[model samples]
Target chain A: MVHNLWTELYIVLLLLAAVVIISQCYITYLFHKYEQAKIWKVIGILFPLGLNIYIYQIIKLEKRLNNFLQIASMERRDWRTAYLLVLAQYLLLFAVFGLFASP
Target chain B: MSKRSKARIIFFLYILVLLCFDTTYSFMIFNLFLAFAALELSFLLPLFRIRNNKEIVMSMFFVVTFILLSPNAIYVVTDLIHLTFFDFDFMEGLELKEWWNFTILVSGVFLALFYYVLMMDQVRAFLGRSKWMNLILLLMIILSSIGVYIGRFLRFHSIHIFTEPLTVVFQIVHSLDYSSVLFIGWMTILQIIICWLFLDEVGVKNGT
Candidate 1:
């Protein structure tokens, strides 16, 4: 039973990792598309593990997009709030792991 | 005064406290310190930007030492196996007795993670803007995963590369077992993931 739970935990961890990576990669794509930031593309490809870099890029990209739209008097919703959600999810993930990891 | 330096000092202080409680683990701490020092040497060498041939050769020496010892940082994770040896039998009325084991285990995990992240950053910096950076990162992951396996299950220390070079080579020449393959495979992937997460959170903002 414990082995089964551990396996399930591992599966959950893998899924969590996959979700983070996919979202981060998409964020990198958004940066490239909207901000014309080819440097993020280089970093995304070369240092694919730079999640924080991706987050930073996404935040900057959002600000730039908002600024560009604002010149036309159009308002864009702030998506930087996603960073807080990501932080919370990671904290919860660790909490779950700690709860189940005791042998 | 930098954040990294402050983290390093905290790591050492934690180790010192651990040693005070359990002096028998001095050898393990000594081995870890050697690995940490080798990593710092590697990280700092490139910053010097030596142009002369003599200086280049000296830098190469440090690079070799770093390559040999950096795996020891990853290898430190395997030292978690040592926790099984601790006497867990509870003594009544002993203040913070049972909690000591928990403290040691958590601190060791933090320290190992700290070392691994720093070493990975230094290595990426060492590789700096190479055209083949991706390929190099892939190569490092594979090689370091193998290095960790050899260090852990094969009982080979980094110093053995110098003292028993031939034996080390001979052992590595042999076939890899199933566990070694799985260990290497997962470790490589996880190492890359952790490396990505640990890099600057602000990304390339402010032209960093």
Candidate 2:
């Protein structure tokens, strides 16, 4: 039973990582289309394991999109999806590591 | 909210979550904080406009501090050795706690590398794109690898450079050997690959 639980948890974590990577890729596409996309942003899609979402957040907050029409057409919340996914990934990892285990 | 404020809040919340899980890892938390602080310093260092000789001197001081603290970020990668604590046989089932610990440790390692890359990116921007800037980055990675070696094997902290400068230097000189040199070279290569993949993509225009 314990082994099964571990497998399930591992699968969940893998799925979360995959979703985060996809979200990051989407964000990179958006940045490329509407803004002065950074190389780091492209690299983030290729290696979504670390720093991509954080970089996305930093860029989103620091600069406005070059094409105002694109910004107006897109929902504001669209830009935040990757950030939320990354946060969820961290929260899940920490919650399992910290709260579920007995001291 | 400002970028700095948002980053701080996220970092604070991360710490709070970790503390809530286990206070025994306070030392790890402290190290993470130090790495985060160094990353923030690097990010902020570029924004400072030097107006006079005094400002330039202060900026230089902060630059040195950033370089010294920067190694702590990469040093976190060495902490993966702790994962050996969860020794389990294939014959036996894995425990939930052990599995979670493994997950957390790997995540922490990734996060630390991420921090190192982000910090280097900021420093790269501060230095601008040039052959000399690339050389400086290579030099920084080599120094950081040596710093990791010193920290991991010598068990010396970065602060020791200021407090016990002679002993630290002496120990570093004496500790030189084939194995240590090999380790530093391997680490430097690993860091360069990471930088090449993440920070130095070819054919991509630099973002403003």
Candidate 3:
């Protein structure tokens, strides 16, 4: 199982590398075709920002799916249970704080 | 900017600030968020929609608790980071005066946890794809968290037998390795998930 997972990971990594190489190649081709090295430089500068944007998109999609689930099923109100969940969240914070806090 | 767009911008900027700064300003921003969340929840929850005593109680509880938890979040991270960076052992070796510095050290650590509970939904959104994307993200988070926990455990465990590095990796006996990378990375992603969840929740509650 581990072997297969590693194999998959390797393949995925290779594909990612390939995509980067291919995009760079395409961009270089376009730059030379248009004699616009300046544009290429701009693309290079913008790539990191693009990745951050991509990450932002993924987070948005995940929330949509979760909302779908919650909507379909009512998060039924049990005050006691709700209160407890609230309290549990609090306790988790408190314990974490105490563990690390200066008394 | 629309209210949400403004909030979204603030929220995203706040997250970046948290990751980058890990300071009292970040904590204050986060605490204010808890206050905002409490106010938002009061109006947006179904119980509040119905208008009852229960709603009032829940809102009050939430407001108070939110205030309490926000600081705790700050405390946890500050403490852990301070201790780790400054090399303060939690054991008997420390003088009382040194403890204050330790608080500031580990402050970044709770930021990881904050990402988990507070931001998971938003992260999922940022990383969102099909079910497969989510599954992959979940796995990544789990692995990174285990990785980070292991690192913390091992470094701390040298103080006593309980801190054994083996104990850190002992989860591997059950296929567990507590790692901060997994924890923080997963949490980083999770915060995105949470942002989306809040948006959705508010959207539904407020009507489109």
Candidate 4:
């Protein structure tokens, strides 16, 4: 009985992970469309486990974007807030899966 | 040196130092060597050209070999069971016993964690911007769990698949019982959780 329950939990967790990954990709797409972030860096963000790479790429783009805005004499909108929320969503999903599926 | 190369050097040096203290157990050294080889293969696997037909074929071979051997890294945890075979009287052999125990346990766990991180980073590099990143990681974890079982309980090394293909295939096909399924499932969950925690911490540190 316990074994069956664990197996079911595993399946559920796997499905949750799939959903989270798809959503992460979608969020990146949205950011790329509206914020003019580079498509390649946004694509790099899809790597679920490459958090360091993702942060590095995002920071690089943000810094460049800040310089461009400064030269253009424009105010910088808080676009990073959207990306942070998406990250938090996937992270919470991972924590939930870990908590429920651990033996 | 790059972060990845630095890690590889540190891991190699660590194994060398530990080998001095682990003289009684040669198999452990062999297992670690296989794990180290797998990490190196993973590091190289992502560099192949995905667009060129020849390069794609070569990279697929690397991918298959990596999946087959990466579990040897995780199987380090199972090596701790060997400690039960040793006879140690706490009062009589406390010093030697404690030292050996610490060496095995610490090295085993450290190598496992390092290999796990190395594999994850390499795989992410391979998957670079793929839409199915999470699904791929989940599948790799499931396969690694089964591979761990084949290594631990069946006493089959990764190279045995090449030398005794038929016997290895038969054993793996026959071992897919309910208990093994449950075992693999739990192990998959544990491995995923560990990797997630490690990567998340790295993300936090790097992001801040």
- Give the alpha carbon lDDT tens digit for every residue of A27-69 in model 3: 3343344334464445433443123222322344225433223
Fraction of native contacts in model 2? 0.00
Docking category of candidate 1 = incorrect
Model 1, span B1-208: residue lDDT tens: 4434544676678668867876434456655665565454443433333445545654465556557667766666666676665565566455364456656665665676676776666566667698897788678768788888887767776656653578777787774878779889988887778777875441222221
Tens-place lDDT digits, model 2, residues B1-208:
5434444565777677677875333456766776786676565553342435645654565567668778988898888888777775656876777776666666667767767777787778777667699899999999999999988898877656654578888999999999999999998998998898887531112332
Poorest lDDT segment (10 consecutive residues) of candidate 4 chain A: A67-76
Cα RMSD (angstroms) for every candidate in the order listed: 21.0, 16.2, 18.0, 17.4
Per-residue CA lDDT of model 4 for B1-208, tens digit only, reads 3444455666667667666754454566666766776665564443332545544554465467668778877777667777665666566756675566657666766776777776676676568688998899889888889889887777676656643578878998898899989989988988888887775443211311
TM-score of chain B of each: 0.80, 0.87, 0.28, 0.83
Which candidate number has the best lDDT? 2
- Residue B98 CA displacement from its true place in model 4, Å: 3.0
Off by over 4 Å in 2: A1-103, B1-10, B23-26, B48-51, B200-208
Residue A33 in model 4: lDDT: 51
Which of the predicted structures, 3 or 4, would earn the higher lDDT when compared with the native? 4
Task: Residues B7-97, candidate 3: write the lDDT tens digits.
Answer: 4455455556656754443444544344334322322232322245655675555543433222222223323443443444558686654
- Give the total clashing residue pairs for model 1: 1
The DockQ-based CAPRI class assigned to model 3 is incorrect
In candidate 4, residue A57 scores what lDDT?
35
